[model samples]
Target: MMRHLLPLLALLAAPAFAKPDADTRAWLARTAELSSDAMEGRDAGSPGHARAIDLVERWFKDARLQPAGEDGSFRQTVPLHEVAVTSAEMRVVAPDGSAVPLKFLHDITPRPATDLPATLGGAMRFAGYCSAKEIGAEAGPALQGKIAVCFGSRRTGRANGAERLAAVTAAGAIALLTIDDVGFLVEPPRWPDAYARSVAHDGVTLPSGLPQFRVNGAALATLIAGSGRLAAAILTDAGLHRDLESFDLPGRFEAKLTTSQRKFTSQQLIGLLPGTDPAKAGEYLLLGAHIDGYGFGEPVNGDALYNGTLDDAAYVALISQLAARRKGKGFARPLLFAAWTAEEKGLLGARWWLQHPTVPKDQLAGVINLDQLRPLFPLKALTLHGLGQNTLADTAKAVAEGLKIGIRPDLEPERNLIRRVDSWPFMEAGIPAVNFIFAFNPRSQEERLYRDWYVRRYHRPQDDMTTPMDLDAAQDFNRFFYLLVETAAHAPETPRLSPKPGT
Candidate 1:
């Protein structure tokens, strides 16, 4: 009895362990290589990212995937242009003529405009939520020549950033400053931004002259200090999405801005595995993950590299691992394995590919994008984007159920994350697509870890190899992904978007 009791106690004392298999171990090893500091965070259009592209191409070649890129090569050059803010200075001139300086990158960060002026300023006016619907009549002559200040919130039904920009721009405001919303805890704003930069495809133009800026939420009180309005009260109202009244501030905004521009190119690596069935060979399923990260940035906690391990490097490695496991074998439908670039710079690579697909657009059946697949805790359920909107949902559900993993629709729709990821472009093109997030029970340890990840390491250098990850969870998700790919690719009918009403 003593011997039996001793064994039971030992087992109970030690936590449950799920050992990673050889394949998962290999997958992580590859992830570490891609996200290593030596890769310089793999920023798009950087030398480091070019090196990563080569590595992925080599991996695909080793897996026996045929080149399906430009001119029968596994490389597609994505034309890109970048603008970096080298310097910026802003001041709030009080009615009495005293100026309060705003710290660059601390109190505010300017979005470098395509036609940014050397200097510009105007009287400041609060524009409530700044939505066209919200601003209604006030957006006309009332905002014609002044700078408009708006609250940035992700609360449901609130206009998104683009709509807000259009509303303020159309109102003839010279500039727009959006105060960061601190209420949104799903993904709170990070202060002292790494840098200020804008990237877009070559030849694409933006709304010129109307510069944009983001004000730190903590500094809102300072901006409204002498306006006779209580900052706390206004902030509380904004945080609660309460109706706010537009008002003129006690000061005029003065500013100086400087920027530098450069043009460079990036690569989108695409490899193909032809289908085994002659009939289904005409169709294809695309598997994609971004290979770019934040690259070099202002030092954070004495570190400056944003390795983007789980943000996408790991998932890119997972794709490579999948290729290796297949060893050149084809599914019922062809598989187009794509490693995208410039995703951090606003999904440029994927968007470009959508416009210039290596395979015929009509033959592309579905897209499965891997990004921000945080495996920080146990993988019990998956929060799927595009969950009931298409046939891909059924395949994902079946695959997840067979693995004993629960599947559910996104419960946090207010975040609007679906439109922010790489899969959005494909989904918008009318192709069925899906993305995933590891789900956790509220108020649980897993929830704590998940939320903490966003605050401490989401886009920071802290997301390096040293960051803690649940190996068991990683392995489980890897298995689920591998099976999901197989199940989706082998299904008799290719995935398609669910029919809409009146279609």
Candidate 2:
């Protein structure tokens, strides 16, 4: 309802801007300690994440939150496998038999490959992007055992490089060597840094097959420098023309690779607060935040510990505080609090729970997801993550209005936030879910405090609870989130998926 939030910020901010409060400072301290350099980026399958989860589970016990996990434990187990590149060797030789070898992880990344080998000999066809339009007319048994020179658009676009490379592997093509397309510009193109960080950390080894390769744009350009024809010219040629002979050099080749899948496990921390109503005590209100961060580094950014502070530790601390407050108060519906493990690894903890829930998934009314807590843009109007999936948004908006805050739609619908957090698994299992954040739009006092104070302390080592935070606002936001949990749990009528559907 932050109905008057805009004007309120204007009236409340210091004339020249000011500092945050105590609660925020404390929250920041806990946040810093959790995601600090000492913690090494709370990775899913790493010791760092294990310690973080253990600490959280201990705190949950100390808070007197009931044990609400499988059997009598406060933890859930998730299993995973990794497919890594073990050993590899690649070379480009001419008809004259001169060798042109490339480095394995450097000169060309094998890009993820299948678990088989491929050999192609005859005429190498330069397939531009492997697009139907480019290679549509070049159908030939000749392409059956030959190489295909195409340009992978890199990580910046919708062009599924891995998927397309997979087709080459299936086609039994010796190998696929691609370059950057002009559209593959330098903006880094909205890559999935979050998931990528996690997957890279939880790095796996896969089987070998028709592998893929990509060179840096400049190095690729340099590789093409002496060539008389442009890449597109050779790739799109209709006939196996003599002019395109350079790209067809040493048409016969064999590519072999083997990536073995390996197994590993992690734990999810769970605790509960019993319900007040005898009848609905069996029902549950699920609240969650991921305790894990990127475990290991990938090829792109070598940051080992993906110490995720604002990404989620803040939310965990917030949930922990709520548990402390409600432990004695008693909720109408049982409260199931979770600090997930391996969340970065494809929400494995959540997925595991859905497959083996402590309580029947059908009895659950809804889920409240806590991931990022920073007011990224000083939310003028709170944005609903799933647009219109639940009345929870309406309830949240109503609360905001009551608090004189505003409400708005999400900036990016394509992101599908509702499906990205822990709440998503529950929603998929048929429960309502919502993710809320502290936002300051319309340049409110809160928004001002954020830019003037919160941003720098965000995910960095500085996110310590001691760092100056707007404690008052933190209290308000945390309480507001807790209220949502309380209201949904105790309300005479359960929160439901809005008629139109929401998240």
Q: Determine which window of 10 residues in candidate 2 has minimal summed lDDT.
A: 189-198
Clashes of each: 0, 60
**Any runs in candidate 2 off by more than 4 Å, and if so which?**
1-19, 86-143, 146-261, 296-303, 414-418, 436-476, 500-503
| Candidate 2: tens digits of C-alpha lDDT, residues 1-503 | 13123323442353522444544544545565576655567777677778887778877887798777767988877776665555456555445556455555455545543443433223355554564433434532345677766665433232356655665555556667765443322222221122211132233444345655555333343334334555455433421221223243332333344454456777788898888799886678888898887644432343434456666777887788777655556777888898887676667788778877888778877777887466433334565564477766667677777766676675444334556677777777657777765555544666565554333433333333333334455556765786677677777777787675242
Candidate 2 versus the native: TM-score?
Answer: 0.71
**Most lDDT-accurate candidate:** 1
Each candidate's TM vs. the true structure?
A: 0.93, 0.71
Clash pairs for candidate 1: none
Scored by TM-score, the top model is 1
Candidate 1's residue-wise lDDT over 112-174, tens digit each? 777988898998788888999867766556788889889987787787798888898888888
For candidate 1, the 10 contiguous residues with the lowest summed lDDT are 3-12
